[model samples]
Target chain A: MKLGPSRFLGRRRPREYAGGGRKAAVQLYHVSKSYTAGHYALRDVSLEFGRGEFVFLTGPSGAGKTSLLKLIFAAERPSEGQIVVLGRNAPRLGPAATPPLRRRIGVVFQDFKLLPRRTVEENVALALEVVGAPRRDNRAKVFAILKQLGLQHRRFHHPLSLSGGEQQRVAIARALVNEPEILLADEPTGNLDPELTVEIMDLIAQTSTRGTTVIVATHDYGIVNRYAKRCVRLEGGRVVEDAPAHGATP
Target chain B: MSRAAAQLASFLRAALRGITASPLTSGIAIATIGVTLVLLGAFALLVANMERMLDDVGDALHVTAFLEEGLAPEAQRELASKAATVEGVASVRIVSKDEALARFRGGVGRGAALLEGLSENPLPASLEIGLADGYRSASGLARVSGSLDGLPGISDLTSGQDWVEGYLRAIALVRGIGWGLAVILALATLLIVANTIRLAVLSRRDELEILALVGASRAYVGTPFLLEGLIQGAAGGVLALLLLYAVFRLVLPGFEFGLELVLGGVAPRFFTASEAALLLAAGSGLGLFGAAAALASESRP
Candidate 1:
């Protein structure tokens, strides 16, 4: 894979060099996350995702897909072992360092997580606002992404007023507004009809062509088969299958 | 124009939106701060007037040194010149025994006939020592009185030091009570404001989660809430200022007699513009800190 710009965030990030020109965008080394004394959300899962790679996390209902995404974003620390994201150790990124790291990655949820009270444009602008982007630039960037998602006309409308597809599109607009290097979508199309599901999935897939590592966690085998991308199947918190994409990914 | 300004504008917009979304709770917080400031302002106004009257009285304060019996007029005049040399003594007037008697007689009104029974002048001759303008407070009076007390021909000395001390004590007591009340009310107001902002935080938990996912730092996510509290507090300050001014103008007349008792006919004055601004700032501080306390108590992403 051709190297994109290294946006490993601030100077304090550990293993920032991560030794020259490595292509791995994320690497998990026997990572385990547990919430209870005898139970594990993810148990000894090790995975490596290269830059610009598109992968699907396929699993049953409680198969630790969300946990993996959370760990990748530094939202959760591993109970054991190491997870590196964007050249920084995921578990060691302190509270101050996490946001800038997360800034380089975008995560979309099943519920579309748009602020209901804010207009669609404002919801998307949140990403840029956090980074103190100038208002004009924030507005132009937000408009460009909203236009890309084909929801520019709904910019002033609140989330509650939009259909689920449009709402999900707004969420995607927010996630992509900053042009993140990594895109994680946990069931991006979970609430949509099959038609909207493909529409959303195609939009998410288009991001990988721009050299963003894409990870979509979903239980629907139909989506897994349709995309035929590099697939990492998880069962009982462990990777059961790692299949290469049937077609070109990057 | 700049990114920091843009962020500030964003925070302000969010704060206004939060206020508009829950006008009732916001209004309650503002009203709480306004009421607290109103009582505090009232005490402040009263103390200000009393202190002003005290200051006005400072100009006329004097130390009187009574002459010993049989002191000649020349000796009395010499004592007056000597007292004039003391520090903080602006001037001295020697009132002879006959003048003192006459003044006493004239001051007794219709009862002057009773004083006529005394064949001789009974009042002591004294040098009335006027204090320098700057030397009128309790401490200043003490300094001048101390110097005049041991004069060669002077048997006794008296001044308004006791009265000045009493007035200062009264002012201190009022100021102490006002500050104590301010502290208690401010605490209550802060808690109420905190709870109000806490509810706002709880209501917007989803928005916060989204922001967090988008790489917003905790400060980024918490700023709007803090701004909301600050806005609420500042508005409350404005409310209290208006209320206090209205009362000063419209309602203070009914307490004319009370004002006379404290100010001695001196016109009451409202808080000056700078003082008013200070009150507003205090309100804003309370709101900002209240929001901070609330945010600190909250568990955020």
Candidate 2:
């Protein structure tokens, strides 16, 4: 399948590279993962995501979309392949190297996984606290991001008290608080209503404009179709189609 | 605040938050630790004072010569007078059976009532002799005992030197047992705290994974639990010290006169500054150790 830039829909076009020149933000070569004998979750899958690109990974249940994203996030090691994330060799990075690498990357899971006992702002500020950022700086960044997400009023509320959509936004806010170079979101809108879905997707799509590489794994075709970005469809542990943005010349 | 100071404050806050979050579990853990520390403190106090008592008894060497039952009063007096002139003997006095019985009743204290039912005094009259200063050394004492052996009309001799040696042996045995008990209790503390921390870790497993995902270091993820354990242990130590002080200053004093009748009234001493500090330090150190053990065994994805 041909892959190229798509229409920006009146937004600033996120820069796209013509071919491999600068190192990819994420690259997987011949990657494979297995839980037991003869049941591979991923197999010989090779893909590259450039900096400042927004891509969608689409598949039905058991289609390896989550596995592929997890591999890139360094949450799981490949059985027999080389995976490089933002320049460091993933498998060789060891335990000591994961935190720094993970700091440069942000990941959002479907469950939100917000600390229930922490307040909304405290939950978001956790991203800054771990890095030993100054309290004033952490507070400023947390509040600014919360305000941008329309969550300033709920900053002091506990996560459990927030609705599903609000919690997801807080999760996203936490992911983007540090201005990470890469963001991996898995089914971020799976539990949201239609209107909230669009709001969350738009919020996520807006991050690409600021030079953050975003990869969203989802089964929602309508959402994917509307956004009209590069889409990689996975089936049975392999990439079946790599389609570029709609209305772009191949 | 400085960066390190800020981090410590954050860690402490997290620990306090955790403690307050599950008061039941934390309370149970803290109570278990406090009781353990009190037991350790009480044992230490007992052993320290017992050793002091042994030292005092060791320094005052004396010999007792028992006469056969129903010995003539003149013969007892003659024997005591002769013993007083023996070389290395400082002084000698004869004690009647009545005096012996009175001393026995006094030593037994509350148990003195048991003797009231006795048909007659079973005690034997004897000569109580003190050793001169030169004969108080171990060798000198042994030599005096040898001289006293097989004296005329003397049935059996009890030497303060022998009792002192026996007391030392008993003290050593007791200390060995105390150390063993301390070791066992320490191991129990570690296991209990480790299990408690492990449960705490499990309850917050999602948060820990999130922290790890957000680029928090293992040390960062584990520090708060370490602090939790340290606080629990140190708090338990403080509680134990309070318990010990209450026992020493309030409870044990009421029994002082009775105890003096038997063990000579050497009151149990409270732990010194260094000893109390050690307990606190040990409590915190064990807390850290327990958390470390739990972290080591944690199964990370």
Candidate 3:
């Protein structure tokens, strides 16, 4: 792996950290999660995502792709094994510490998970709002991001009024609005057409270019092939393939 | 901003926005709280007024001691003096047998004819003994009566101790019943608030989950609902206060008139400021606690 300049910069210089880096953005060793006794959602898995690297987590439904994303966000704790993001050791992070870690990561769900009652702008602003960005700055920032996403025209419209692709774009805008260190997307283009999928991937790639460590979990082979990033494929709660985007064979 | 402050601000903003988003539901919740508070307030006022009336009646009561007919005026005067010295006795007055007969005759002028042909007045002379307020208990009066029985020239002695004792017991019983009812009603109020908040939480479960996922602490998620509960409780308290005031305004005049006709005096029907404040605090506390209980129960992992 070739170390990129983007890897060494502090989190403040988000744009300077763009491109492949040697340092791991996230590292998990033998991580396993079970909701109930003897029912494992994820088996022993070890993986590392480098800074500013764009990667695809490909797996079938119930293959623990969502669970993996959740673990990164500290939404679910591992029953066994070490999971670390940034510098914090997860599982060891108490309930009180989880929020600060979560603040460092931005997540986009497959459902676009936008609050239907809230406007497009509000949905994007929600990320900043939760972190207590000043009201005046939040409004300006929200508008700037909405305009960047070409959602300025529908900024005031409720999410339900938007098309599937548009809603997904809003979700991306929300995930990126905070300029977090790591971006985790679960099936970001799951319901979109191929063209919209490409557009979303381009936006995600652009986000990585801005120095966010982007990890997208999806079943879309076209997205993985077109993007030509690192790919980590999962099967039956275990990693089946981990390779560079072009050279990967499953 | 400091982290906790920042988190609190975020929670407040989100909660305010959420409540504003569903104005109709919030309105209903506030109204429910108000109505319940009003019911409680009205009940409290009724209890307060009943207690006041009992106090007034109790204050006027005195024990009457009838003497044997053979006791002379000197003996009656001595008895009065001795009665006044008893531990519970506030004051004592001697009533001669002739005066007693005259009073009886005056009470039944036409009926006095039914007692014609009586050779001598058969009525006993009496001493009226007023008891001190603190020592007006049945047991205390019984002690006085027992000591009076040992006095010389007191062939037969009678006091209104039995009736006074029964009245005291009745008052205590009524007060116990009133308090029991109040407690039951308060619990019911708490249940109502808890159930309402639980529904509110359920309706916004997705929002709460998202907030939680995004690093909103349990307190942040719970505070808005707690505030909602406080709002509901305060509104209810105000409503109850208003309802009580309205009832007192509308019904008190008629009640006072009836009481005046029966007891020959006017009585007031209003709670003191302290009493109202206490009631309001109680209603609000119940609301806040109920909501807190519901939130705590739901938020537990």
Candidate 4:
């Protein structure tokens, strides 16, 4: 049956599944990433994340949480694994293939990696611009996203002029501007107050309601306890637990 | 908009943004290029004028052969005829000794009475022979002298060999100096262009890196800088042309009368349209290559 324009068109496609129901958004089978011969960031890790899943990656500073996020974003390749992101094998795809994959995934770095010279509006507009959106549409979409993030008033101000919380909001606005199907945040609230931390986590949880899968990597246990979503706990490069926060133990 | 037009617009906007970000540095670069181009233009004019002057001097000279004192008019005529038949000789004119004395008296009219004490005309009849352009060299004149030395009535075969050799050597030296100056100045021009481009690129490195991160092709990042280089070069070339014109105009009037007496007209020291066009093309090419080299060298992983 012809069902209008495919929802997956220009959106993230589902990852391939052996038994398909709601196919996994991200699937890593026996994945291992090693920078050098004796050092492996992730070792034989097998995991699957279904569509619209909200998961927390908790681990100590050097426990491979960041590495796992990097792999998902196609920033780094696995030495031995099948990393399928939105149905495309990460290792098989070359440099040219990464941009399109990246366009569908939103990334909020821990350092709020915003261009200091650009205004808040411009920072958010970059995401839309990268995806080849029309100029007029990009302007309107960026403004709307900024207004939603409570940063419309500071649109003309550069990131350096903004407070930490405001800068974090701008970063979030930039990541979510393109309405990416997958949102990846690394230490999104590591520098925020308890109230601000809950607010950021609530915003992430709300985004998953709109069918956007959110994966946040952090060392903050307080946030994971409060949000109480599916937690993928890692210790020393191995997944110690992959289960729902308040569900039956597995 | 068409695809190329859209791309061009994007590049233009980006270049404009870059220039706005650092106007002082760009201005300095443009001025440096202008000065270099002006020097090169002046050198070109000097070479052109020197070549023209040499050509004029070579064309005006000839060989003059004096006849023996006891030679008859018939013998002188036969000798003139034989000299004209020489392979390198273009034309021969025979002047009798009496005619020579009369010409000398006319030249020094007030001193004519001083010459009356002479028993006879001291001047000897001479045959002046014009040499072809290819035979105007010292070696060629030597061949002509060998052919005419044994002819009847010909006592002395004197050509302007010394003067010709001196002029040839002077021209060769000047040409060598001009070439050396051109080479040194061209290298200076290249260095100036390269440094200017490097500064411009350094100022825009952040923008370039951002473009790369966004998946903009390398060509997209590089085309505007190349265009900027071409614009600077063309502007510099025109500035050089104007500066040369001004200098020539200031100096030309003072030399007009003296030059007219020497060359029969005022000599111009400016490039013709075709030559100016060549200078402009060369300047633009140099600028483009300099920018390309800077880009290639600075683009690292």
Candidate 5:
């Protein structure tokens, strides 16, 4: 049922997502984002996440983790540097080009970002609707994704009716439903208990296993240690450490 | 289907949802549009009817040259024939004193009893001359009247040109005021629509930002608001048309009759199809512009 990439139809396959093509999933070069004069949220940060890699961006609050993720999603542009996502210069993408770029990258926020007024199925279908995916295919994909996330029973319920874990899963379903080339999660497990935290972490790990380059940002070193992925640490808007997780092979 | 067609359908659905979500704002906007359009339509109808009345008077183009009180029948006939031969003159008919008296009685109707005290006919014999088509203008009528005034056995000349000039001035004033009001009302409608749509945009900024973030283009996000504006504008126009029809059918006839009492035989006029269609188009234009204004202001970083 899948037609080939038609850019005008918003169905173009980005380089990283196209059948295991090898490319930098994300690259930042001397990137800086400042909200106020002389107050940098991220300053001269250069980083890279390889195709099919799982990485964690670990930082305390206000350590520019969110700002860097936003740059990857093209939500915020670098003040004085370049950001390349899925092999496209993210900061240079024109307004018309940005949405298609965003479609190839999935993002989950700390607050879940699920629409409270929409049912779980509707929330997940939003990604498809915006791109004009066929209605029948959208319903099938939404149901399949919801089932994969173990939220199939709650598909008809509003986000407000779900627990924190279920809602976060729905948010993840929305993010991953389009099979994006890259997944950026900013503290997805921030509000969950330890049991739910491990489940969400494992779910994200599974996507990385499917060759979707996944970057999860958090201040929680416990999950980072348990999952044992490569870790990049940030402090005061700069990367302080970059290494494999404690139990992971180099 | 094409991506744009799909997008349009989605936007329309969203726009309908938006309207249903906020009843008060949408109602206020639609009501404001209706009121503004009604005022404009009424003025247009008034102007149309007044122009019709003026044309009815102008088409006759009659000027009466009164013969001297003691002029002989032969002399009066000669005066009438001479008036007919003037360059702009179409035809001339002589009215004797008896005919003048009979016309006056017919005009006064029941009030003709008041003229019974006069022993002899006090009205003068006159020659009523009709000007040709091109001579009905102010300058044309003036030239013909001037020539008739110099004719033999003529004492005075009178024409409806003065009345036409007065009516023309009234029409000019009405038109000026109508246009002035139209501009003011149009601006008011624009501002009202813009403000209302702006409020809707502000209320939904978070939703819009999310749409923007989730692979929705500017058109995808903004088209629904544009549709909202268009629907609101069209609804207002339809309401105004309905109200105008009600007024024209139920309330205007009595007023028209009273006007006829003062200025006889003038009939009321309503909006023609073309005029109504223009009003609808204008209303939709207002809606589109208002939505555009809202979208532009919100697009700022």
Candidate 6:
């Protein structure tokens, strides 16, 4: 009630989270979210995304892929159950407390969500700026991240001037600039061509290799088939398939 | 640079961008604040000068105890000594009938022949009383005058207390009206400025959503708006000061006769350095508060 630091008393790690003796990065216990009465975006669903895991949330429009991602990021509270992310209860955090938690979890979107007026470097530096990173170091870190994404030359260009693939890279650069522990992308390549789709997904997949838990909510099965990764398929607000990936690549 | 300085730079950049993004709205807010402060500052100056004039008048406290006509010189002298001992009376000097007549002739320089026709001296011998510092106000004047009223040798007592009281009342009335005007205008200015900033904030709803998506806190998000308001307000204050100074210098001297009648030999003046700084600070305060109000209102629901 005080909106202070939370002491979650009942966080005894469940059996589902204890995979290979490591706790999950994200866990939901029958979480349900409803925007209105008798209607739900996500209902009676439970899932776990482990540290350094790459998971794809595949479902049709309104199948709650976005809702599940929203719940994990604390964008909206679960109506029925608890969600634990980065050892903190997502539902218990207040408006003031949410930012610190969000700082550690990077998010990307289909629309890129970049401030159009700002250049690529400025947009990417937003993550560091929020944490009060010094300007010299902020520039250095932004440069390093943009370079990693191969968009360093375009850092000074505005997002509006960038191609769809390039804008998504800017978004990914911002998401990875902080080296967040958890990366959630809501349809990161939804607007790109088949060729650019592979390019963007490769960057996001690379984040998981660096021990960042990456969740990409997408409806594209072609990209999912290309990579052998754990895939959670949702239908009518319920998870009908939770298939763990067989290998890193097929 | 330090982390704080980096954050400060970020906030200032955003604030400047916000102001530049909507120059017309920002300019309107600044102008309204300037106009409001100008009116308020003028009233404050008037009240300050009036109070100073009253202070000067109070320092020259003088009371006259007009003695009964044909009183003996020895009796008048005795009465003067007794009056000096009265509470609140600092000193007394006896003005004989002949001296009073001579002073009257000097006062009416061109009309001395009007008094030359008089058979006997019409002026009475009196005691000129100087009041103590504590007895310089209206209440003190009344207390001292009452004590001398029924004295055997004195026919009447008169002092400047009555006229001072009337003038003080007039000053109070003007001050009251000034404050009333200030309150109404301040409220109007605050509302307009608040709405202007609110509209500005609302226009950037998309940017805010993105900031939120990137995990920016409420303070982190709202600080730019606050700074924008503060800059606008301070600019407004500077504007008001310049306008007031211009009016005081270029326009005030044109009404020299009116100023002389009201202020006497006292120079009509402009705001001192500290007073001008205070006006600027007030404008900044209005702008800062207006932005805060806008942020608070927008946050609700």
Angstrom error at residue B228, model 4: 4.6
For model 2, fnat equals: 0.82
True contacts kept of 6: 0.66
Indicate the worst ten consecutive residues by lDDT in candidate 5 chain B.
B255-264
- Please write out the lDDT profile of model 3 over residues B1-301, one tens digit for every residue: 7667766666656556655766776566556666666665655555565556546755765667887768778888988888788777888888788888899989998998977889998888888777787755556667767767767666655655676566556556656765776677667777777877787899888877667655565665688888777766776777778877887788667776665643346365676889878867876787788889888788678
TM-score of each: 0.91, 0.78, 0.82, 0.70, 0.86, 0.93
Q: Grade the docking of candidate 3.
A: acceptable
Clashing pairs in 4: none
Task: Name model 2 segments beyond 4 Å from true.
Answer: A1-22, A245-250, B58-159
- Per-candidate DockQ values are 0.75, 0.62, 0.35, 0.19, 0.49, 0.66
Off by over 4 Å in 5: A1-22, A247-250, B1-6, B67-89, B96-125, B134-155, B254-258, B261-263
Question: Model 3: clashing residue pairs?
Answer: B33-B236, B34-B236, B38-B240
Residue-by-residue lDDT tens digits, candidate 5, A140-244: 999999999999999999999899999999989999999999999999999999999999999999999998999999998898888777888888998777776
| Native-referenced DockQ of model 2 | 0.62
Cα lDDT tens digits for candidate 6, B1-301: 6668768887999999999999999999999999999999999888888877777888887899999988888888889888988899998999888999999999999899998789999898889999898898888899999888888989988899888898789789889988999889888888988998899889999889878878899999999999999999999999999998899989998998987777765776678899989999989999999999999999887
What count of clashes does model 3 give? 3
Give a tens-digit lDDT track for model 1, residues B143-185. 9988788789999988889988988999999999999999999
How do the residues B1-301 of candidate 5 rate in per-residue lDDT, one tens digit apiece?
Answer: 7777776777899999888888999999999998988988888887788888876777877888888999998887777777878999998999999999999999999999999999999999988899898888667788899888777798999997787777778778888888999899889988889888899898887787767767998888888999999999999899999999999899877686676843458777678899899989878888888888888987877
Tens digits of per-residue lDDT for model 2 on A87-127?
A: 77877788878889999998888899899888999999999
Worst ten in a row by lDDT for model 6 chain B: B260-269
Residue lDDT tens for model 4, B153-200: 778888867866775676577667667866786677667766777887
Better of 2 and 6 by DockQ: 6
Question: Candidates' lDDT values, in order?
Answer: 0.87, 0.83, 0.76, 0.75, 0.84, 0.87
Model 3 ranges with Cα > 4 A deviation: A1-23, A35-39, A92-94, B1-43, B109-117, B137-140, B143-149, B155-161, B179-192, B236-268
For model 1, the docking class works out as medium
